[model samples]
Target: MTGDFRYRLERGGVKYACPACRQQRRFVRYVDTLTGEQVADEVGRCDREDSCGYHLRPSEYFRQTGTKPPTAAARRKEPMPEPEPSSIDAETAGRSLTGYGHNNFALWLCSVFGEEIAFRLVDAYHVGTSRHWPGASIFWQQDVTGKIRGGKIMLYDAVTGRRVKEPFNHVTWVHKALKIELYHLRQCLFGEHLLAADPVKPVAVVESEKTAIVAAGFMPEYIWTATAGKGNLKVVKLGLLRGREVTLFPDLGAFEKWKAAVDQMPGVRVSDVLERRASEEDRVAGLDLADFILREQAINV
Candidate 1:
């Protein structure tokens, strides 16, 4: 019997009330592949972005219920194959650092934080420009051990510093773009390489690479890093933070999602700054830490 491991919307085409808001047709439930059953009634997401944002992953459900989901070995009749470790050599990582003239994000950073600080941030994070699209920047995910795992390429508006998602949702990975076959890509936290630079500084994590850079510029006290996305905050990727003080500054709509995920993680704390201070308008706009910092900077100026 061949089976695949994935999650799909429960009862396709049927409307289900959201667990959080009770809104109909927005809820999507996770279905267990092995048992051919819904894992949990509330283990899914609500599509409503503004009013109701509820997403409970299978992993979160398992953690909450104190139950272990079926392992790969158990799920498949055949023996599970081990995945190979993927790596980007130092040379490739070095080559990416060469072109900063067309790096719009870097140029924008230079304007906001000034040349010295912006150059430092770029060098520290291995921020690169891609000829793939003019003004496209690469946020390389270098591991704590100084290995280049991969890079996430994204296009941003130079003046606004906002990501350009329309006309294609401009995002791609270095590994995929290079067509590195058999490369088992495993992404670590963005800016993770900074951990090796300062063993004493407490780590502050956000959801976007832009936020990390901006936050780091304003508050040099804490080492700022990003998960790259809310869902990418996995326990495995956080292993390097074992004994270190770690704080999560999730985006406005992501506080609960991150809080629940890190409950069992020792030495990890979630910041409630945005949750406590944000107005309904800010929440609706999906404001993040970077937005907060910029607002304060503008006020002080």
Candidate 2:
């Protein structure tokens, strides 16, 4: 398939430059048939910003991905992925974030964090595998500055031939691969979830997936989605959280800034992770949904 796609952009109203050439292209405001909002500045990059002195402004590279120009009817017909089924009896939402393609770790990520961060992961890691997990495609995100926001590991199921769908599936595989206990898997997944959830999510975002797992223990359900680097936050999908309430869960290192960002969101709450309250050796290090479950068990004990 051809990589170069074209869009009719306006003369001078767009934000980002091209990733390849860094040229500032013109904007082409189109009436979004669904939202009815005039969608200005299509997603794209410049082709001439580097080699040529001219900046091929915004809305250029978005077309570069090879999407066909939509007619009035076709644009209206485009559909979005449906939200995950929510069961009131289940008491909690089935991981707000859906899995991207097939990464076992990525799915676990969604279970822990809400959907916003999972989309961020998908944007970053969609490029296929690298050193971390050979032959495995990671889902992740990066800001326009190319900073890595967050990401996760993934694997395929043997019997089903389908991508493993839940945190338990990832843990089961990890248990088999590393001969680790459910405790470890629980700790890792729960820890990351904590970091992606809660009060004042941290923001000294880093790139190492394992490091993210380790840091996850420090915060519950904060915004710890992985990115390739800075300048790639555009990949982060806070939009997925349009109507829901969210909290800030920061990584161990960047708590202050992370807290600030969380405060900025319209409707988010925050809580502290009580590290000293643990009675068991494997108790999740920080307070989180996972730790919350542990606490309930602790009270019963």
Candidate 3:
């Protein structure tokens, strides 16, 4: 038997009924590469890893079920262990905590929430201003353990609070800018580090760092965090938030995709506020929760 089985957990966070507990959206099914289908109904992992340890890999499934997977080409080589991602020094993070006076994003935040509240939120998030672009802000992604994962540098319009996308979408990473060689980026949520401050606080997750900051202003009840970008959603990284009460707010056109992500994450819920309230124009513009919130608060932007 050629060991060319390219079995993998299916993408889009599609979960099924757990064979062990008969629970829905907790089981991750395995898929056969060649056939473009699931290996078996019972072959997969249950997201309830602690409470219900039900895991059946494809090879084990074939062996026990008395079935041979179709052979393909070469024997699969042993996979190499991945290197641990690099972290920025705390000193670097400290140095960035300056220049906020000239930061466009910081100015916009002040305009929305007034100077006192705006600066308080900025200090709490440890957000920094950057010299990378004129009036750029750096949203540093720190882990729950307080390690600096990475910094996202982006230029924003001082008045509108919108990212400056006209002049080629000014965005870059701090690590890349430093010319750090072979830097492997393993990102956590944008403001995940705040969880340690209040472990029991429910987290409100959005698609942009700016949204997280804005939402935190209005709703001090929930710990607002951002995934940095929609494509930045990774199951394993998000699974770190398993025990916490988390709510996801995806952009207008991205509801289904983020809903699928919420499925794999057992207790997490996806908010349908945007989907329920947005007009066709709002959908076409792909507005986020922060936009609706600002309007609700009557904060002219």
Candidate 4:
């Protein structure tokens, strides 16, 4: 009953090659989102109630391990505030698009990919520049329905194309900066608008907006998107991908966490390419999909 513990459908009920029955698509696992850990190795349950009755709950695992379960108070659900009308109108997002020269991220992107490719990305993702900090950029989150959910403003090192997290973490939200009182912010996936644009294309989800943009540039086959954070992969946000093929590319050290989380959601697959290919040093450094792509691009160049 812990707020951090919630049950969700595994792989949207996609049948996988079951270990017990050797059948497909009948496994679900309990995950602790707080710590990004799977509760137990054998906690996955098969849906075949009779034939493959492989079920293991977190409670049972805790009992077997002699560990105390979360208290009822910790499990009590807190009321979520209802989303009010967003004050972040389209005009606000549009304004940031005016000056790319000031956008450090875009400038860096232009250097790596050239102006033509970089500008295309700028237009495709609606990348913008913010005066909040010189060379700061804004990643606008627009939903499939064409609604501007919110904008994440961040500062980046123009030379490296990496976020400038030092000096007090240069990141902020549009609604908060504007001081729009009672603005109920309902965030959607970054680059979610692409889902409506191409329904047939499979989805490739990543952890950062920067990664999504870079991946889409290199591989245009899949409709790339970003959850914007490791812990932001909420079940509600994934509802859009219910009927589509979705693949998750978590950063190094995140494969197991993402695999466990996506196991309950059908049609979602977590890639092990990084896990298999990355060295121990790469894993420790937390290299992501973008790093690999960049490294390969450099090699070719």
lDDT, candidate 4, equals 0.78
* Candidate 2: Cα lDDT at 195: 34
Q: State model 1's lDDT.
A: 0.82
Residue-wise C-alpha lDDT for candidate 4, range 69-168, written one tens digit per residue: 5555654466655766473788878988878988899999998889999999889998888888899999999988899989999998999888898878
- Worst lDDT run of 10 residues, candidate 2, spans 85-94
Cα lDDT tens digits for candidate 1, 1-301: 2222465556656557888998887888888866567778888879897777788887778888998777767667656676755888888867889677788899889889899999999998899888778889999998888888888999988888889998879999888888888888788889999999888888888889999899888888788899898788872355688778888888877889999998888888988787888899988887777888888752111
Alpha-carbon TM-score of each model against the true structure = 0.71, 0.25, 0.72, 0.70
Model 1 stretches astray by more than 4 angstroms: 1-82, 235-238, 298-301
Worst lDDT 10-window in candidate 1: 1-10
In angstroms, give how far residue 53 of model 3 lies from its true place.
49
lDDT of 4 at 48: 90
Ranking by lDDT: 3, 1, 4, 2
Which prediction has the highest TM-score against the true structure? 3
Model 3 per-residue lDDT tens digits across residues 1-301: 2343578888888989999999999999888776677888898999998999999998888888898886544333446667787899999988989888889998999999999999998888878989888799888988988888889999999998998998598999999889898998888888888888886888888898988898889888889888889777772255567678888888777889888766766788888778888888887886677898887752211
- Model 2 regions more than 4 Å off: 1-137, 140-238, 274-301
In model 4, what lDDT does residue 161 have?
A: 85
Q: Each prediction's Cα lDDT score?
A: 0.82, 0.37, 0.83, 0.78
